[model samples]
Target: MKKIVLTSFALVGLLISTSCGNNKKEAEKVEVEKEQVTPTETESTEKETSESSTIVAIAAANENFTTLVAAVKAADLVETLNSAGPFTVFAPLNDAFGKLPEGTLDGLLKPESKETLTSILTYHVVSGEFKAADVVKAINDNNGSFVITTVQGGNLTASLDGDSVILTDSKGNKSKVVLTDVDASNGVIHAIDTVVMP
Candidate 1:
């Protein structure tokens, strides 16, 4: 059988409904360099004590994920990402969110847009853990492409771009995975260059 990963979280689907159409507007190619920064050893270890943290913590600690962290809060998904049982999150960096058309971000952040925002965020998440190597293997095993079902009931197509993993969202937007295998106590995060629409 071809390798295809499909995980349906009925409970998660119950929590989110309705996708925002406005987010489908043509997006600019965000400059990833502006979003990521080299972490110094001291800042990297912020605390001398060794304590396992969750995905939310890892994202909150990194300046590159500021926008993502805020969106999680806005969507009230901080607790979900903090939970156990390894999730695979295609996290978009700050500049990725910046790529959205004008007013799109602000509109999604509004209280009225919570449902749409929740669906959009969850669309970037997969139920189980999938490392970069795992994704690559699955794609190659499935004849250069694999379709992954998101928690939101939307599908994301995973394929290869040279050595990189590319995710094509429901809206046909493509995001290149720039950073992968960011392990957390709860899950792993792969940073992407664009915000994939649901």
Candidate 2:
């Protein structure tokens, strides 16, 4: 009888010990998994941000420009825009296109109006890189204003007041810089609210 009781107690002890061992192993495994996964998640986030910047650069590239794509191709300015020489383009968003009068975009797309289209598009481009800071400095040094010569030989004058950058074209058209400092490998882009016609 005594031997049987001892065996029963030993069996219970063994079962309890086995259960505790399993629990400890499971807890350790969970901690190890979390540690292993943490760095991967952080790296993934960094990779995504890097990829987003690249996509922005590619999309801002002249060939893939949203509003300017058709016009660039129509005017055969793709090669010029994609060349090695860096350029700072005052890019107009699609909504800026909507601001134009009806039939304006269509009229420009016609083959007969190629010269006009090219000039207008080129007016948005400068020969070299000009960041917002440079523009602001030039404007301040020139009595609150500075004039830039476009690649098309047209003139674009800008004024800096407070935090806003205001632009005026040779045709007496005015535009506002809505967004700025979109970086690219080749150059940079400043998103303007209006399209300045040459």
Candidate 3:
């Protein structure tokens, strides 16, 4: 009888131990699932924030720059402009476009003039971020003159005269940086009264 009782007690203890081990294993699995889910959620949220911060478009503040807008779209450089770069754009207003001969804007919009138009528009862009103060400093460092290389493979001369900045193109045409440092999410825009050709 004692042997029977002893054997029954051993069986009960083994069953209890097995049941407790199973419960612990289930709890550990739940914890591991939670840990994996948390990191995935964090990574997805970070990606969304980074994408949302990018600039996707540009709006010209005047009718004169209509030519610029069309060229940007035609050159497929709209994506570059919409990127996350803090670019500095020398934006010429509508009156500046009028400086071009009549029908010039229309001609440039044609398919044949696409390449030329693209070059002209890219001549206005410079890589990296530069404010008015930085421009002035650059000019001062170069003895009131500095050369700026455009994305269009042209050189533009920047000159500082007291409080005014002058931009001269390769074609010997001059445009004053009438308004300096208009800040943008992707870059800076400087308003000029005249268009600079590449």
**For this target, which candidate reaches the highest TM-score against the unseen true structure?**
1
Order the candidate numbers by TM-score, best to worst: 1, 3, 2
On lDDT, the candidate that comes out on top is 1
Candidate 1 local lDDT, 69-174, one digit each (tens): 9999999998788777589999999999999999999999999999999999999999999999999999999999999999999999999989999999988989
lDDT, candidates in the order shown: 0.86, 0.81, 0.80
Report how far off residue 114 is in candidate 1 (Å): 0.3
Q: What's the number of clashes in each of the models?
A: 0, 0, 2
What lDDT does candidate 3 reach at residue 95? Answer: 78
* Clashing residue pairs in candidate 1 (N, C-alpha, C atoms within 3 angstroms): none
What's the CA RMSD for each of the models?
A: 28.7, 9.6, 4.8
**Model 3 TM-score relative to the real fold:** 0.69
Task: Pull out the clashing pairs in model 2.
Answer: none
For candidate 3, give the lDDT of residue 77. 72
Model 1 score (lDDT): 0.86
Could you tell me every candidate's TM-score relative to the true structure? 0.74, 0.67, 0.69
Error of 1 at 50 (Å): 10
How do the residues 11-130 of candidate 2 rate in per-residue lDDT, one tens digit apiece? 999999999999999999999999999999999997665544442345545442576777777898866766554778887777777789999999999999999999998899888888
